[model samples]
Target: MKKLITYIVIIAIFITGGTALTGCYVSSKVANKSGAQLWGENCNRCHNAPGPGEFNNDNWDIIGTHMQIRANLTKTEVDKITEFLKSANN
Candidate 1:
């Protein structure tokens, strides 16, 4: 009976630990994708210039709208770029 309890406890620990670690991994992935740096040196040549960490409520939506057309970026690229900009908290 003791051994059975111990085994159950171990399994529970493993399950809980695994879940917590998985959450951390997921959060890190989101941060990584959002935190990606937008290189103005290349990105700006075709689009209006964006300052790193400069995307605030004042300009993010507008910038996102204008950039998609000027850069001719696809929806995915636009989303990624906008996400990155938002993550910059500009």
Candidate 2:
């Protein structure tokens, strides 16, 4: 019983730590100038200036697919732009 409790505690700590780290990374990514510029140039061309949550989180995947078709972005650009959108949610 004690072992099981210890294991659960460890898992909880890891999950909490991971969430904190992800928050920091997302915040930094959103603040990055290159990311901001990319979003303005690429995303804003079509979107009104609301914010990421203007669409639901799942909508980002659909929007990214459309962007892939419309902009002919490389895989890296697509990934980075997706990350930028995700960061805005946090």
Winner by TM-score: 2
The TM-score values for the models, in the order shown, are 0.44, 0.49
lDDT of 2 by residue, 1-90 (tens): 999999999999998998788654645554554644676777667765346566766787787777889976545556667667777777
User: Each model's C-alpha lDDT?
Assistant: 0.63, 0.69
Write candidate 1's Cα lDDT for 1-90 as tens digits.
999999999999998998788654645444444324444433767656666577685476677667678766545456666666676663
Worst 10-residue lDDT window, candidate 1? 33-42
- Write down the RMSD of all candidates, one decimal each: 13.5, 11.8
Shift of residue 47 alpha carbon in model 2, Å = 5.8
Superposed Cα RMSD, model 2? 11.8
- Clash pairs for candidate 1: 54-90, 55-90, 56-90
Model 2 scores a TM of 0.49
